[model samples]
Target: MASPQQYLNNPNVRKLLDVIASAEGVRHGYNTIFGNERFSNLSAHPNVRKSFRQTDGKTNFTTAAGRYQFLKGTWDGLSRQYNLKDFSPQSQDIGAIGLIMQKGALGDVLKGNYQAAIQKLGGTWASLPSSPYAQPKRSQAEINKLLGGSAQQGGYQPQYLSAKDEVRLFGKSQPQTIRQKYLSAEDEAKLFPQQQPPATRYLSAEDEVRLFQQSNQNTQQSSYLTPEQEAKLFPGG
Candidate 1:
């Protein structure tokens, strides 16, 4: 049977985790809480929920912590799946790998297929350059630089690359047209009407009473005892 620490044992996974921690902004501080605070718990996930102001002055609430900044609910499910014992460094790596495997990006990640891996994980962690979120992001070139690529190839900025530039950097691609994406809720509802459960049937008060009486009479009729049985039960009754 595979142990819970399987991902932590693999050298490739260890290296990948190091890179990912840097991307998530927790390389030096594993217990780095959301909004740049520090946590001191390792026994379990530090599910300290908080609302902090963003650079834009908007408030954002989070329970995100540790290297990958796992949300409480997200960690709960991943921990169960990966059998993570605690929020230790090893456990975090294993749990992070479990998430990568869940997204079908583990194979790509191990193969050093950066673009493919980042694309797969875009919607998951909002830190990657491929992510569509409006958060602070590490550019494609910047992350590649972490992977030991030249500064000329991987730019210095912490921003995304243009489509043309990305094509120039990484050869092949699969661009998603607007039509290929899923429809919005209202449009989807128009196309496929919401399915409702069948209505429940209920008997009237009069019908319920009649059914109870009929059932009681049937029970009595079915419970008929022989003369010998009646004599044994009630001698003179």
Candidate 2:
């Protein structure tokens, strides 16, 4: 049998392990952000720094709390190095959702009726809808429509165009540039809200080709099939 060090040294396996470790670290960090007592305490522990590094075949952290602290410190250090800031309420809520989803804890928490856990870990209790899964809140226009009012009455315009509009504006073959610009603008607006005006334009060569391929595939598949064939393929009439 291969030794643990030998297994870790294999290039392909090592890469896969690295990816898994990174994902695990992120999940742990997010969970810690929620209501994980061990992780929360460990993050603030002074001994955590000394324990994380293995030296001269000597391991650190004999206690569970010590190990947890070491892991939290390692994760927090990595987060700082990578500039990952989940300090905001919205960001923390999203982080908790991601952790819950990754760990398969959503159903368990919901079933247990751990309301305090849910509220503390997931942020505002009012944000939770009837559904167990987290969903995007309705846009102002959608809310207005639901209330039987026009979008203008809600004081917000739908600046984002539909996928169809995107394909029309930038031909299917060329979409990357426009898409990048749009994403950059959006990020800038998010980071510096006062600096960026609302932008509606989005044209990208890569996106165009992608969208076109999907649309074209749908069109081609539909064209040759009879209604009966389509019904058979899709199941529902």
Candidate 3:
């Protein structure tokens, strides 16, 4: 099983993570399977029904599990293909990439084909800006922000190409190592500063309950557990 640390060093994985981070943020530990408070069970959510191990007896609905919010059926197929051990943040990251590759969108992502990539991935992540399903949709600009493209400006910056190709296009190309082309610490820091990016936090069960209770009333209540459901989740108050 590849550890999160091991996956971290892989530039390809890091870049893919940037895409997920931009789309999902860290809400509900969207990109992590551990290292948070409340919702302690990374593999399951109290109000959610289905999990990789079992389904919640209350509602027969299948929960999208893990950081990438993969449904149990999806994870089952990916786990065997990738030999994943657990749904640790790293494992989940790997699983997501596998799905992207399966859809043939990895190259589009690396090449900064934001629209095409989003369209390809929309089938898997319903929240994608390109998805037809009605839900919170990420704008192409948000996705392009992480992709280092100019889509926000109505064009896309070409991804790092071969030095010869770069010279052919622009008459000059900065010397870059293969790894340097893929690694983007600056971009990661820009999107999610190390000091503290918005919404990534640890909360005690009480704090979590209170936080949700005080959340914006306008938000769709059905999207999250109701206070009554939460009370049932953490009983004996």
Prediction-by-prediction clash tally = 0, 9, 0
Query: Model 3 off-target regions past 4 Å?
Result: 1-13, 28-38, 42-47, 50-62, 148-237
Q: List the residue pairs that clash in candidate 2.
A: 174-204, 174-205, 175-204, 175-205, 175-206, 176-204, 176-205, 176-206, 178-203
Error of 1 at 184 (Å): 56
Worst 10 residues of 2 by lDDT: 62-71
Q: What's the TM-score of each model vs. the native?
A: 0.57, 0.18, 0.48
Higher-lDDT candidate of 2 and 3:
3
Q: Rank the candidates by lDDT, best first.
A: 1, 3, 2
| Highest-scoring model, lDDT | 1
Best by TM-score: 1
lDDT of 1 by residue, 1-237 (tens): 444355566666666666677888873467788877887788899899988665467878879899888889999998888777799977777778777787888777667665677688877787788888656788887788776662132346444445654444444565554223334555444444545333323444554564455564444332344565456444754
Q: Between which residue pairs do clashes occur in model 3?
A: none
- Decide which is better by lDDT, 1 or 2: 1
- Ten residues in a row with the worst lDDT in model 3? 51-60
Q: Give per-residue CA lDDT, model 2, range 1-237, as digits (tens).
A: 222222333443333222222322334442333112234432232232333223345554421122111234443543454343543323333333334434344443434423323333222221222223232222334333332342122255445645665565555787466453243455545545777554323424543464356464544322244555445444633
User: Model 1: which residue pairs collide?
Assistant: none
